[model samples]
Target chain A: MAALNIEQIALDIASPLAEEPGALLPILHALQEHFAYIPTEVVPGVAQLLNLSRAEVHGVISFYDWFQAEPSGASTLYICRAESCQAMGSAAVEAAAKQHLGIDYHQTSDDGRITLQPIYCLGNCACSPAVMLDEKLYSRVSAESLVAMLDNLPERES
Target chain B: MSVRVYVPSDSTALSLGADDIARGLGEIDLDIEIIRNGSRGLCWLEPLLEIDSPEGRLGFANVTAKELSTLFSDGVPGSAHPRCLGLTEELPYLKQQRRLTSARIGLMKPCSLDDYRAQGGFTGLTKALEMSCEEIVACVTDSGLRGRGGAAFPTGIKWQTVLSAEGDKKYIVCNADEGDSGTYVDRLIMECDPYTLIEGIIIASLAVNADEGYIYCRAEYPLALERLQQAIELATDAGYLKHFKLQVRKAAGAYICGEETSLLESLEGKRGQVRFRPPLPAIEGLFGKPTVVNNVISLASIPGILAGGAASYQAYGSGRSRGTLTVQLAGNIKRGGLVEVPFGLSLRQLLEDFGGGTASGRPIKAVQAGGPLGAYIPPALFDTPLDYEAFKAIGAMVGHGGLVVFDDSADLGQMARFAMEFCAVESCGKCTPCRIGSVRGVEVIDRIHQGEQVEENRILLRDLCQTMIDGSLCALGGMAPFPVLSVMEHFPDEL
Candidate 1:
């Protein structure tokens, strides 16, 4: 993995805010948008700019599940494990995805193409089984469809 | 020539292939402007189509890709065929609703700033910027709007407490961790009309004299989290959230943190655990200063109360439960979605009229109003008004306005055990009644199921429930018994 260019990213983020006390969220958003995660090194820079402690900045970043410190895979696949989705056979779909992608929940693939995550509910209960690939939600997802979808994705190592 | 096309992003609509319809429409080579809006609350005929008209947005009950071509050629969006609830304005399910919090939901394009402004989005903040903190508190107080996050404490009282406190750096935290089963109203409101929630939070911060705010949403709602983040950006750029320094914080899938104190603890990057309440969140919350901790529904409802004044909101409902409740209808229902209705509507009316009964084509044996903590009411008690006091009279709560129905096939004993087990798993373990009592309750229910001294176990379970209710520190332990006890008492045959 390439070392995160924290100073460059922080500089990029700092230029937009102009030292606003309330720039923490925007800075965090900007960092996450650019790198898909907040690097640990940027904590002090964020703290200094926002007039907050390093721990305070870290606390706010870690509190939100969407904010990650580590670099994420190119794509994320969220499989629904809520009761409604479970009732329809998400377990089998999950198994198929895990087998096909070669990654467990919260783990990125070896090639770094995808990260598998288990979400409790997608609010697509009526459709029974659901899986969200990035921002797009696919309902009534079967094991076959799951495999097909994974196969269709662009290979990261290539 | 502009064409208005509406595609509902409501869960029920999505479940019924609205996404496919939207994708198909996007692919079509037609000069049509698509507006992906929230549900109209007419869940029965979902994927409901509508077009811009001189009268208003003309409604069609349900339309597929095939029907869309014909409807467009006709130049008239006709009535909902076969299942037309007629005009959305006339439907009792929608007509009777106060719609304060959900006023902009289906009326405006969700992500469009122009639509939000046209539908009175940030009017409250604009009005509130002129008022003093005390006057803002007084306005909320006069409105009689209580916290819709299950506690039913007056919103005005909570804000007044924060306003009166001394602090240079206060925080306003909006608890969007709606962990309750069969409840997606918060998610709906967040996804469909994100500005309302942002506006509410901004207004709330201004009222409480807080400079910063955080919206603690659960990880389960990724779509809601994404939309809220996007909305925050939009709000910031447009100077709504920027004026108050508010940001939406996402939770790491903790159900217990739906409680205010627990939510505060989680915001500080600690485990989502409940804290004791003598200090009270209003006095010392969110990094040990004054904080205004509110639920998504509670915060979102503030803008309307401020805009319409308290009297206009107060005049809608009965007793202390003034204003409206954004009731979420889910589970085994033919029609399931978010419906913002006035407090006076009866359970029977909501279930039969809005919900259209069980989706399984069977009789609804039981209905669990509120979240899992709420009691399992029998069909005989369907006529009971859904007001907070009325629900309390029947040993129930309108908790977060989640109403889940179950068909005749449901097993009451199993359902009772599930509730106890749920409480056991989700308990913060701060107090004993919830920690140990839930385990014992589960054991006793299991004993009954096994017919091992069934009658004695039933008595034992009842006694345990009473002890837990009286001895528990918070609602987690206290309300856990409601579902178990209510099912045993009301649905003896099912058990």
Candidate 2:
């Protein structure tokens, strides 16, 4: 990751959306997309631009599971833990992944290779126990397949 | 002429490696035109590749990368193949369906406005352009379209309220925050037939006198979000959306956000907390103004209702549950996918005829209708017809019309525990019963499972459920007990 001037980046992102209704989400989304996480330093800049309290911005950011405070691992794996997936033994799949990765949900590997998160549904109930690595969705994902997929991913450091 | 090979780009199909199939076919030098369409909802047979034959779209199931070369070599759709499933409509699972709202889903290019118009797409909006707001609301009221997002409140009535409400800047917000498990129909439509939803939103905007709109799609559905953004851009550029300004907002993960008030709060860039309902959304919503918040399906169905006319749409369904229900078959079911049909169908027909029973080849022990909040109906009540009133009569809701099948291998006790856990995890903490009672419900179920004062815990569980039902502000707490109590009532042995 490049060394970013937080003030400049936040201004560039938040300036355009300043006039829009409920501009906080868009500003946050832009920051998250560009940096992969919302840095604490950008909070004051966003709050100043949007004229919202830093606490309000923080509240919004913290409420959403999508918004992260720290930079995530190179790859994020979202495993559906909802009812349909649960029915098709996703619990077992999740258990196996946690065991293999040696990390629980919402936690990253020590090497910062992967971040595991629990999703409610992937809207792929027919193909139960669905998994998503970033944008790509994989269904019928058993623990073995997920582990293999993780192993093959290009190694990266946080 | 090149053969038109339709491959589903729907999430379920994509999850099953449909992208690989599409890419592999594109790389080949074959004279085949690949059309990425939505899933026909026959999930077991996906990635269901269809060839536009003279007879109709001939179907092939589970087409993998290895089979692609063989499929092309054997004259493709022209020759007989082992994997071929004959005509797409002839498949008993699809043939029995009455796909009105989903008519153009699997047949057209999802993002192309031209393709959408070619398939009777914006006819409703055109008709709506001519009609008065009251007339439009009346047409929908006559059509009897209800909220497909769990609550079966009449959409037309809601629209009428929003239309009549005195607000200078009313809003039409489409709830695409499809957090329900075993439900993919909304996502499918938004991805496969986005124009329908866009057109429906336009019609809704026109009907409610709301010029500005926002589609609150969840962040989990990247593909759906992408497709919708594309569709909106094209529609905007083409001047098809001149009447209304539309924008898609990504909903940060919150199950309570699916609730209208919570969704409005989230839209305002606040924590998705449930709001008190004396000032209903129709009167004062979305920035403290009158808002018409409709589900994706409820809005998507508007175009169909308008194009076909209210009487024609009203003619299809049974009783007050007018219009077809897009029932999602999921979980352990064999043919799990979207099944759009009139509301008169029985659970037996949905489970046995459409679902092909349990995927495990074991007898189905239980089925959870609606969603996680729905009751776990025992196999004995398979004959129960799929109607809002009928389902309500049996202490169940046809919530979002998602049915998850469970064979004998499933433990109802675990499912009951999960229902409580889901509520606890997703609750907005607005009310005590939902926030605290869900935790207590899980503890009681766990205690019962551990054989520690089982009868006493069961009684305590029932009492807690009643309190939650009575005390909770929203359906999250109120309906959490349905699954628990149903599991206890029907499958006490499993519990």
The per-residue C-alpha lDDT of model 2 at residue B488 equals 82
Q: Per-residue lDDT for B169-250 in model 1, tens only?
A: 8899998988776677787788788889988888888888898889888766767787888878876787765557777776
Candidate 1 structure, TM-score to reference: 0.81
What DockQ does each listed candidate score?
A: 0.16, 0.77
Specify the poorest-scoring 10-residue window by lDDT in model 1 chain B: B76-85
lDDT of each: 0.78, 0.89
Candidate number with greatest DockQ: 2
Off by over 4 Å in 1: A1-158, B10-16, B27-29, B65-87, B90-92, B493-495
Model 2 lDDT tens row, B1-495:
988998898887887878899999998787889998877878888898999888889898998877788788756655276778889889887887999998887887789777888898889888988999899999999998989998989999999999989998999999999999999999999989999999899999888889899999999999999999998999999998887899999988888899999999988878899999889999999999999999999999999899889999999877778889999999988888889999989999998998889887899988898888999998788888989998888888899999988888888889999999999999998799999999998898889899999889889999999999999999999999999889888888856
The alpha-carbon lDDT assigned to residue B331 of candidate 1 equals: 65
